[model samples]
Target: MKRLPLEGIRVADLTMVWAGPFATKILAEMGAEVIKVESPQAWDLVRTLIPMPGVEEFWNCSYYFNDYNRDKKSVTLHLADPRGRELFLRLVERSDVVIENYRADVLDKLGLGYEVLRERKRDIILVSMAGFGKTGPEREYVGYGPIIEQMAGLASLTGYGDDGVPYKTGISYGDPVAGAAAAGAVALALIRRQRTGEGAFIDLAQREVMATLIGEAFVRASLRGEVPPHRGNRDERYAPQGVYRCFGEDRWVAISVRSDEEWRRLAQAIGRPDLASLTLPERKARHDELDRAIEAWTEQIRPQVAAQVLQAVGVPAAPVIDTEAIHDDPNLVAREFWVTLPHPRMKPWRQPRSPWRLAEANPTPRRHAPLFGEHNTEILGGLLGLSQEEIAELEAAGIVGRAPVDARPGG
Candidate 1:
C-alpha cells in the first residue's frame, strides 16, 4: 500500500460531538494516529445521545458516534484530576497536534490552554474550535450547529419568498463546514511549523466559518446596504431556476436555465417553442409562469426522468434525492462513493467515503471506531511508559476506564 499524506503524524483529539470528531476523522483517514481523549466521568455526549433501547454497552454501540469516530484510538482521562492532566501532558509531548471544540472558555478554565500546552511541547499545534472565538464578546455564549446557522445569516436567506420566516438546514450544516475548515487549518499549521519551526494556536470560530459560505451577502450588505432576500431555490443570476414537484409524492427536481440558449432548449423540451425565443429579461419577468409550465411537464414524470430529459437537452437539472435514496443513487454508486467497514458491535453498514480523492495515494478506512478507553494501556503504557501498577491505580481511581461513569444522554 502507498503511504498516505498524514502518515506518521500523531494527534491528541479532545473534540466531541460532531464538529471536532468530524475533523479528526478526516485526519485519521489520511493516516494520522488520532488519540481521542474522554473523561470517564464526562464522556462525549454523542456516545449515548441516541441510546439503543435493548443493547448492552449502549455507549460503545451508538451508530452516530461510531460513524464519525472511525479510525482512531480512544483513551479515557479526567483532565480535572492532577495525575490525569500530568499523563495528558506527557502524551502531548509526543503529539504533533491537539484539537478541541469546547466552548471558548472551557479549555482555558480547565487550565490546559495553548500557553500551558506550549510549555510542555514547544512546537505543538493547538486548534480551538468554539462556536464563537475565544476573545470575542460572544465567546461566553454557547451554541450548536442550528443556532450557529441562524446567527451566521444563512437561515435568513433560506425561506420561501412567500413565507415571512427563516428556515434551518435539514442537517447540522455548520458542523461539517467547520470540520472541513479545521482539517485544512491543521494542514496549513503543520506546513508553517515545518518551515518556521514554530507552533500555531488556531482559534477557529464556527460562526465565522459559516459566514464565509455566504460572502456575497456580506458584500451586498456593505456595498449597497442591501440584505439578501429569501428566494427559496431561485438564483439571482439564473432565470427559471427552481425545484419543481415531480410525479411521485414528495419527489422534486431542480432545474436551472443559465443562458438564453439553455432556456430555449428547456422551453422546446417541454413543447413551448414560443417561449423559447424569450430573452433573459423576459424569462426573469415571467419566472413564475415558466415555473408553472415546467411543473406541468414534470408533474407527470418521475424526478429522475425529468432530470434526465432536461439534462439530455442541455439544461442544467438533477433530482433532489432524499436521504435514503441518496445511498442508492446510480451516479454515486458508479463512483464508488460508499464503503462498508466491519464493526464488532454492529452489522456492516455502508458509510460515505471521503470526497477528497487523491488519485495516487488513495485513502481508505482502516478500522472501526475504538471502544471507550480501548487504548488506555496501549497509549499510557506503550507510549508514555507508565508501569502496569500505575495503570491499574489510574483505572481504579476513575482516571481511565472502558465505560463512562453514570453515562447518560445530555448529562
Candidate 2:
C-alpha cells in the first residue's frame, strides 16, 4: 500500500450539514485526520433528521449522518464557553487546516475567525464555505442547496419548455459540487503554503460555485441575447436527444444522437430505417414525433435491455438508473463504486465509495463515523497533553461531552 496524499495533515472540521461534511469526507478519504467538532447545544441536525423509531442512541444511529461523516473522529464542545474556546484554540495549534460552513458572520461573531486560528498556528489554512462569501452584501442571508440553485440561475434553466417555470433538482445538488471545490481549494492552499510559508483564508461561496457549472449559459446570455428557455431533458445542440419510457413502470432510457451517423444507427436499431435519412433540422422539428416512435419501440423492452441494444449498435444510450437500481447497476458494481463499512449502532450497509480514483494511493474508508464526542479523551488528553483530571473538569462544565446536552430526538 502507498501513503495517502494527506497522511500527516490534521483538519479541525467545524462543519455540519452536507457541504462542509462532504468536503471533510473527501479530505478524510485522502488520509487526513479529520476531527469533527460540534457544539453540545447545537449538534448536527442530520443525526436526528431521520431517527430510527425506538433507538435510544438515535443521534449516533442516523445513516444520513454516518454516510458522510465516516472515517472521522467526533468531539463535542460549546464554543460560546470560554473553556471550550481555549480548548479549540489548543486543537488548532496542532492542526494544519480548519474548515467550516457556517453563515458568513457566524465564525467572526464567535471570535474564532481566520486571524485567530492563524495566531494559534501560523501556517493554518481556513476554508470558509458560506452560502454567500464573507464580505458580500448578501453574506447575512442564510440558505441551503435549493436556495443556492435558484439564486445561482440553475433553476431558471431547468424546466419543461412549455411551463416557463423553474424547477429545483431532486437532490441537494449544490452541496456536493461546492464540497468537491472546497476539497480542491484545500489542496491548492496547501500547495501555495509549501512555497510561500504563509496561511490562507479561503472564502468559497456556495452560490458562486453552483453558478460555475453553467458558464456556457452566461456566455450565451452575454454574446447572443439568449435567455435559455427550458428544454426539459432536450439538449440545444443534439436533435434527437431525450429520455424515453421503457417497459417497466417508471423505467426509462436516455438516448442522444450526436451526429447523423448515430441517428442512423438508432433509427435502424429501432426498426425505423426509413427515418434514418432525415436531416438534423428535420429531426429537431419532428422531435415529438420521433420521441413517440422511439418510445413505442422502447416501451416493449426493459430499460437496461433497450440501453444495451442501442449501445451495441453504436448509439449513445443509457438507462436512467433510479435511486434504488443505481446501487445494483452492473457498470457501477464492476468498478466497485460502493463499499460496506461496519457501524457500531447500525447494520453494515453499502455506501458510495469516493469517486476519486487515485490509482496509486487507492483510498478506502477506514472506520465508521465516531460516536458523538468519542474522541474527546484521545484528542484532548492524548494529543493536546491535557491531564485526565483537566478533561473531567471540561466535561463536567458542559464544555465537552459524549452526547449532545440539548439533544432533541426526531425534532
Candidate 3:
C-alpha cells in the first residue's frame, strides 16, 4: 500500500457535529491518528440527532455519523473535570494538533485555553472554528448550520425565481464548506510549523468562508451597486443554462450552452433549424420557453441519454446524482470513490472514499471509527504513562469512560 500523506501526525479532535468531524474525517482518511475527544455529559449531537426505530445503539449504528467519522479513535473525557482536563493536557502535549469547533468561549470557560495547552506543549497547532470567530461583534450569537446560513448572507442568495423568500439547500451546506476550509488550514499550518517550529493559532469563521463563495456578487455590489436576482439556475453569462427533467422519479440533467457554436450545435441536435441563428440576447430573453422546449424532448428520455445526447452535441450536461444514485454512478464506481467496511453494530454500506486523489500518496480508509473511548487505556495508560490504578480512579471519578452513562440505546 502507498503510504498516506499524514501518516505520522496525531490530532486531538475536540469538535462535535459536522464541521469539525468532517475535517477530522478527511485527516483520518489521509492517515492521521485522530483522537476524537468528546464530553461524557454532552456527546456529539450528531450521535443522537436522528433515532432509528427498531435498531439498538443507533448512535454507533448511524450511517450518517459513521460515514463521516471513519478512520479515527474515540475517547470520552469530561474536560470540565479537573482530572479530565489534566489528562487531556497530557494528550495535547503528545499531539501535533488540537482542533475544536466549540463556541469561542467554551475552552476558556473550561480553563483549557490555547495558552494553557501551549504551556504544556510549546509547539502545538490549534485550530478553532467558531461561527463568527473568537473576536467580533457577532461572536456571542449561538448558531447551528441553518442559522449560519442565514447569518452568512448565503440564504438570501438562494430562492425560486417566483418567490422573494430565501431557501436553503437540501443539506447543511455551510457545515461541509467550513469543514473543507478548516482541513486546508490544517495543511497550511503544518507546513508553516515545518519552517518556524512554532505553534500557530487558526481562527476560522464559518460565515466568512461562506461569504467568500459570493465574491462576484460582492464585486457587483461594490462597483455596480446591485444585488443579484435569483436566475433560477440560469447563468448570467450564458444564454441558456438550466436543469431539464428526464424520465424517472425526479431525474434531471443540468445543461449549459457556453458559446454560440455550442448553441448552434444544440439547436441542430434538437432539430430546431429556425432557432439556430438566434443571437445570445434573443435566446437569453426566451430562456424559459427554451427550457420548456428542452424538457419536452427530455421528459421521456432517460437522464443518461439526455446527458450523453447534449454532451455529444457539444453542450455541457450532467445528470444530477443524488445520494442513493451516487453509489451506483459508473464513473464514480470505476474511479473507486466508494468503499464498503463491515461493522459489528451496523450493516455494511457504501461509504465515500476521500476525493483527494494524491496519485503518489493514494490515501485509503484504514478502519471504522473507534467505539466510544476505545483507546482510553492505550492513550492514557501506555502513551501518557499513567498507572492502571490512577486510570481506574479517573474512571471512578467519571473522568474517563468507554461510553457515556446516559447512552441508552438511541431509539
The prediction achieving the highest TM-score against the true structure is 2
Q: What local distance difference test score does each model get?
A: 0.92, 0.91, 0.85
Looking at model 3, residue 120 earns an lDDT score of 92
Tens digit of per-residue lDDT, candidate 1, span 50-167: 8556778889888899889999999999999988999999999999999999989998888899999999999999999999988879997886999999999999888887966999
Off by over 4 Å in 2: none
User: If candidate 1 were superposed on the true structure by all CA atoms, what would the RMSD be?
Assistant: 1.5
Arranged by lDDT with the best first, the candidates are 1, 2, 3
User: Ten consecutive residues with minimal summed lDDT in candidate 2?
Assistant: 402-411
Give the lDDT of residue 287 in candidate 3.
87
| Lowest lDDT 10-residue stretch of candidate 1 | 50-59
lDDT of 2 at 44: 84
Better of 1 and 3 by TM-score: 1
Report the lDDT tens digits of candidate 3 across residue range 1-411.
Answer: 678888899999999889889999988988889999977777787776664557766667666777778899988788998888888998999999999998889989998888998999898999999988999887766557887888777877788668778888788888999999999999898999999998889999988888898788788889999888877688889978988898999999998988899988888877676778878999998988888878888898998898898888778999988879888988888999888887877778788788888888877777887667778888888888989998898888888876666765542
Assess every candidate by TM-score.
Answer: 0.96, 0.97, 0.95
State which candidate, 1 or 3, has the greater lDDT: 1
